[model samples]
Target: MEITGNKFALIGLGDFGAHLAMVLSEKGAEVLAIDQNMDNLEEVKDSVAHTVCLDATEEKALMSQGIDEYDAVIVCIGDEFEETLLVVTVLQSLGVKRIIARATTPRHAQILRHLQIKEVILPAVDAADRLANKLLFQSKLSSLELSSDYEIIEVDAPDKFVGKNLRELELRVHYDVSLITIKRIELKPRLLGGTREVEHIIGIPSPDTVIERGDVLMLFGKKESVQRMMAD
Candidate 1:
C-alpha cells in the first residue's frame, strides 16, 4: 500500500476528506491537505505530509504550491458546488493526471460529468445502498456479479446436501452449476499486535471435502441456473 514518491492533494477538510487523508497517509502516500478553515487544517496536521489553509480556486497560488506535481487530486468540497466545480476546472487546466470529485446530489453529478470529470463519488447514496442491502438481505450469505446474465452465490448448506462430496452432488450435471468454494468457520490465533482471532474459510477447497450444516457453499452459473439451484 506504499505510495512513496507519489504526491496527492486533497481539497476540503471536512469529515469525508479528513478521513480519506488519514487513510492515504497510513498507506504511505505523500498527502497534501488543503482547507480554508484553520481549525480543520489543524485537525489533520498530524496525519498528512503537509497542510495549507488556502482556497483551492486560487489557481496561481495552487500552482505555486506545485499542484502539477501531484499524481492525483481529490476535490472533496461537498457543500459548495461552485467551489468544487472551480477547483475541478483549475485542476484539469493545470494538467493534473487524475481528478476525483465528491458530489452531494444527482444534479451536481450530472454537471461534473458534463465538465468531463472522470470520477464522481456520492458517499451518501452509496452508504444508503449498503445499509438497505444489509437490512433486506441479512441472509444473503454471499453474492457476486460475474456478468449481466450470470452470478455466483454461496448460501448455508441445506440439510439434504450434508455429507455429500461435490462430486457426488453432481452440481453441474444435475443443477447446471459449479461449486466454486466452500466457506466454513474456524478459529485462528490472532497475529502479533492484533487483538482478535479471525474466522475465514480457505479458498479453492479440496474436492473430497463434505458439505455440512452451517457450511456456506459458493456456486457459480448462469443467473437462471443459480436461481434454480437456490430454489431447491
Candidate 2:
C-alpha cells in the first residue's frame, strides 16, 4: 500500500504505536514517531521519517516540534488514561484537524468520541494490516443517503476474513444486513496519470461469491448494525 504524499504524527511508541508508524511509513507516508522514552523512539527511528522523545503532556514541548503542521496526529497513549485525556485535550486546543487515539476501554472510547475525535481505536486489538485496511476502505460520503435507518458504504473485507462465501458469512442471518453490490477497482495506466477503473458486481450476490481481502463490499443495513459491523 502506497500513498503518494501524506504526513502523520504518532505519539506513544508502544507496541501498537510502533507498528502503526512502521506501516504508515511503508505505505509511503512520512511518519513522525514520538514518545517520552528514548528507547521507544530508537526502536522505530529507522522506520519513520523522524523520531522524537518528549513529554506530550507538556504543550510547550510538543508544540515546539510543530506537531500541528502534520496532516493528522495519532494518540497512542496506552494505560495512562488521564495522561491520554490530557494530551488529547491539549491537541484539541491546538486545533488539530484529525486526531486518531487509542482508547483502552469502551468508556475511554466514549470520552474520545465525546471530544469529537471520530477515529478512536481499541488498543491491542488492532493489527497493522487491519488498521491499514480500515484506512483503505473507510468510506467517504457520496451524494446519497439510503434511508434514516439504513445505508450503503464501501468497506474492505476484514483482514481475518477468509474468502468466505456469502452464505457462510451469514451477514443477513446474524447482522440483519443485505449485500447490495460488490465493486472491484484497478488502476489503468495513462500517458500522464493513472485512472481508476471500477467494475461492479451488483445484484443479489450468488451464495458462491467469496469475499477477498481487497474486495469492496457495498452493504445495506440498519445504521447501528452497519456501524458495528464496520467497526469490527
Candidate 3:
C-alpha cells in the first residue's frame, strides 16, 4: 500500500474524504485536505501535510492553494449536489490538471459525464481502498477482484518487459500469472488533418506477440502472485 512521492488535494473533508485522505497519507502520499468547515479541517490537520478551510466553490479560493499543480484533485462532496457541481465547474475552469469528483446519484453521474469528467465516482461504491488504489497504482489503470485472493488487473508494461514476447517471459511458469490480453495503442486518422491515438485490446495474444512500451497488459492471477510479478 506504500506508494511514494505522489501529491494530491482532497476537497470536502466529509467522512469519505477524511478516510481517503488518511489512507493516501498513510500510503506515503502528500495530501492537502481542503474544506469550508473548520471542524473537518481540524480533524485531519495532524494526519495530512496541510489542511485549509476555504470554500471550494470559489475559484479564487481554489486558485490561492495552487491545486492545479497537484498530481490530482478529488472533489468528495456527497450531500449538496449543486455545491459539488459548482466546485467541479470551478475546478474545470481553473484548468486543474486532473479532477476526480464524487457523484451522489445516477443523474449527478450523468451530468458529470456530460461535462466530460473522466473520473466520476460514487462514495458508496468507491471507498478508501479503491480510491487509494486508483491514486497509488499509476501503472495499474483498473482492476477487478474475483475473490479474496484472485483478481484481474490492467497494468502498464513494465520497463524491463518492453521488448520481450510472451514465450520468452514465461509468465505462467515463472510468475504464476496469466496474460489475459494486451491493449495496444494505434493512431486512428481523423477526417480533418489529425491523428489521435486509440487503445484497442489485442484479443487472445499469441506467444509471439511482443510487449511494447505503451502496451497495457491485462493480467489475471492470485493477489499475492500478481504483487510478486509486479515487484519482480
**What is candidate 2's TM-score against the reference?**
0.56
Backbone clash tally for model 2? 0
Error of 2 at 168 (Å): 31
lDDT, model 1, position 129: 47
**Clash number by candidate, in order:** 0, 0, 0
Q: lDDT tens string, model 3, 1-232?
A: 1123499999999998999899999988999999999998899999999999998988999899998999889999988989988998999999897888888865777788778776777555435434554475544444443776777877788988889999999999988999999878675542332233445668898999899987888888887887788899
Q: Indicate whether candidate 1 or candidate 2 has the larger lDDT.
A: 1
Candidate number that wins on lDDT, 1 or 3:
3
Local lDDT at 109 for model 2: 76
Mind giving the per-residue lDDT tens digits that candidate 2 earns over 108-227? Answer: 777777777767776433344355544554543354566776777666777655578887888887778788777654443322222223343455678888877567788887777776
Cα-based lDDT for every prediction: 0.78, 0.76, 0.81
lDDT of 1 by residue, 1-232 (tens): 1123567899999999999899899978899999999999999999999999887998887998899888878898989999999999998889987888888987787788788875677777656644664555445544433577666766788888898887787889988888877766543322221111223455786667788766777777787887677688
* lDDT, model 1: 0.78
